[model samples]
Target: MATDDIKDTVEYSEDVKVDEKQNISQHEGIPRPEDLKQDMALQTGEADHELRERERKLLWKIDLRLLPTLSVMYLLASLDRGNIGNARLGGLEADLHLEGNDFYNALSIFYAGYVLCQIPSNLMVKTMRPSRWIGITMTLWGVCSTCMAATKNASGLFAARFFLGCFETGIGPSAPLILSFWYRREEMSSRLAVFLGSSTVAGAFGGALAYAVLGHLQGAQGLSAWRWLFIIEGLPTICLGLLAFVILPDYPASAGKRWLSPEEKELAIQRGASAFNTDTSNFDLRQVKAALLDYKNWLTALVYTGLNAPLASFTSFLPTIVKTLGFTNLQAQLLTIPPYIAACFYLGIMCYLSDKLKQRALFIIIVSMTGTLGYMFLLIGNNVALQYLGACFAAMGLYPLIPLTLSWISNNQLGHSKRAVALAMANTMSQTLSVLGTQIYKTQDAPAYRPGHAICLAFTCLTWGTALVLRYFLKKENASKDKQYGVPGEIDEKHFVGAEDMYDKHPGFRYIL
Candidate 1:
């Protein structure tokens, strides 16, 4: 198991499955990359231990340094999207003289802008510094939200909301690419959960904050308090954007000048040793087209599209949905907090287990199926307690799946250009489905949209079917490769033997099921 020998292994097929057993228990004592290198030589590497330990550190850093900034940023971004729900609770409908899903149509129109902006926004973040690009977008979206505070009519709201979507597009997706810069595959899910749970928290937090603000701003500046909610919620993100440029580290290779030690920099560089997106080589249209040509990217997007349909409903309208179920505005906000809290813990545990087990698809399948059942509870259950618990079930089921699914794709797509585009493409595709999900809560089925419930159930079933299919495909491909040469993924065997060429040539690095 010498370094040279470890580097020499060749893989010939795209489905190069390693043994499913994670060997986590065995990788306990090894510390330091040097030890990891030695363990690699011994063929008894404490890789899992190292990866988990690294993930733990990253999650801590991300939660403290990165997520808070992004959370505030996304809270504003999410607030921009769903303030209509809050406005409906306020006097926006009467003031705007709107009737019958015009607001929903306005909400729907925002995505038309979103779909147009995301790809370009993401591409910019990659070429420019993420800190610079994301920070700038944060400031811009804050301005857009503030403008929403000034809307006089439905047409005004529509204009403000469309611009809001344009500004908000890259904030969520950029956060993941930034995380992917630092964290490994298994570590991504829980971190993603922690970052994303902020939106849910904002629903609760905004509920309370909105109550306080709306009540306080009722007379200020001749605008409604709901308008003030837009002003108040939107401003912090503007300042946060300035702070991000000053504080948030660029990428690891570029950031150590201030915080990370030289030793840490080296480790950071190697941490990406298993980077699915390794080659940042030359780029142009041909490369972009070649990256897009990979079937796996679209397949991943399909899985995410169906899954995001329900999750988007949860985020964009959960507060409104809860208010319909016989709760006061204050009560709805408080109630929303508990389910999101439940999601944080459930997602953390699931991510911990996914990492421990080193598996992705099964967890996704199970969580998704669980979410489908939760939606069923919404459809059939009449008891308030039970229906509320379904909200918690939705959290348990939906939130964890996000991190896992993104990690699955991030770990699958190779090449930085490819991974970046893949993230945007998948998210963009999923969001398109979300536009449909939003419209499904039709005016005709206002209080309880049984059709929406039924559609969610349909999406979850598709998730189950996709997971099963992916599992078999991965296994079958791996076996095929192993028989032809040896290993997973489709890398050439000759270069694989070179000290620096194992991954370069190993033809069997198959996408996960």
Candidate 2:
């Protein structure tokens, strides 16, 4: 069966019904999508090639219109958030006269506002419209980032950091949620990898940008290079935020008046339903409970917190760590580039294979184990080159887990509210841990940060264990559901739009492995 054939021949209805004659194993509950196409071809009275052509065009339009703009938004968000690391090496700490534990406290304080806003910020992505919510938050964070340049002391910097985090909270959780509104689970992992990989690009860019500013712009305007780094990075983000208001579409079904035609919009909604076996429009308290009550959600949150702690700490501290290798500030900035570059390629390959193989847990485990070994090298080795090699391993392993873990939540949960809350909860827990994580690399632990490396290694191992448990419980639940499917009910036609709960609990829905 060709890809286009499935697109052309399958006429997904408003409610997204599958062919009754298709293999409807109540155990798995969902039909093998490929098995339905021939029957669909007979019913729809359209030639496969004709259908394929149209689908190709529609999907291309979506890809072109959505991905690039979103990628840029994410890249800027990352640079704004992670530039603190670059600034540290560029004289930020010294410029503000930060002393004792003040630098670490400044780093950790950002997550205070970050943890508070996670769930509400995501819920607002529903009511405020993704365009408005995302744009508004971006602009606010940019303003806050620019304000960091003016801070004269640790207290002022702490205040700036908290607000920076409060504004940033939306972007991290919201991007995956927005993607969920558009792409199917199978298609999302790679798209998400691309979006997430932008941060790696930002990491590289921040280093180069900081290096350029430090070398050329230092004392140019009676301000330090770190201040200039903040100004240069912050202003553009504000502009990007303005641009998002014009570019980002709302949910596909209602995103009609913009780029998509009425038919295309319907197709987009139907495509979502066909892939997920539920409507994305449904949001409500009950759905929140569904997400909240699922032990799988909490376990996934735990795993995500474990995975995220190391990644977040690494992003904020990598430049400092690399500087310990006897490199000048300039050399340190340049050195940060290779690990980020390595992580970018590593993320692309892992996500490609993950989507192709239709597996998340195994890849997560593989990356987690690689990270564990990297930490071990850092823990035991004193050789500079060997530890640098370990940093590369850690970067590759640690960063890719973010997208995989997010897409895993999308795979496990259905309905808009449930997906939103699940991602929010996981993000919240992870960000909270990130606060504690930042403190792991204290001044006393500097030079090697051995305790930090050890803590990161332990978390990676815990992440692996949690992933195994999550995979097992999901598999077991599917088997139990498969055995107990009773009388069929009439397929519900009404779409739940923040009113009622309807999702994985529906009889015919199946968990995707």
| Most TM-score-accurate candidate | 2
Give a tens-digit lDDT track for model 1, residues 1-513. 445544345322444444449522233342434555676656544675776687566446545777676666776676667666766677777888888878777877778778778788878876888888888877887888888877778888888778877878768777777778777666676667667766666666766776677557787878787888888888887888778788777676775545666756666666665554354423344445645776667777788887888876776667677887898865665566777777767777777777778788888888888788888888887888877888788767787777788887777655566667888898889888888877776657656767877888788778767877776776786677667766544333332343222321246455555
Q: Estimate each model's TM-score.
A: 0.82, 0.88
* Tens digits of per-residue lDDT for model 2, 172-201: 889888888788778888988988889899
The CA lDDT of each predicted structure is: 0.71, 0.83
Q: How far in Å is the alpha carbon of 419 misplaced in model 2?
A: 0.7
Each prediction's total of clashing residue pairs, residues at least 3 apart in sequence or on different chains, is 16, 3
Which one wins on lDDT?
2
**For model 2, what is the C-alpha lDDT against the true structure?**
0.83
Locate the minimum summed-lDDT window of 10 residues in model 2: 490-499
What TM-score does model 1 achieve against the real structure?
A: 0.82
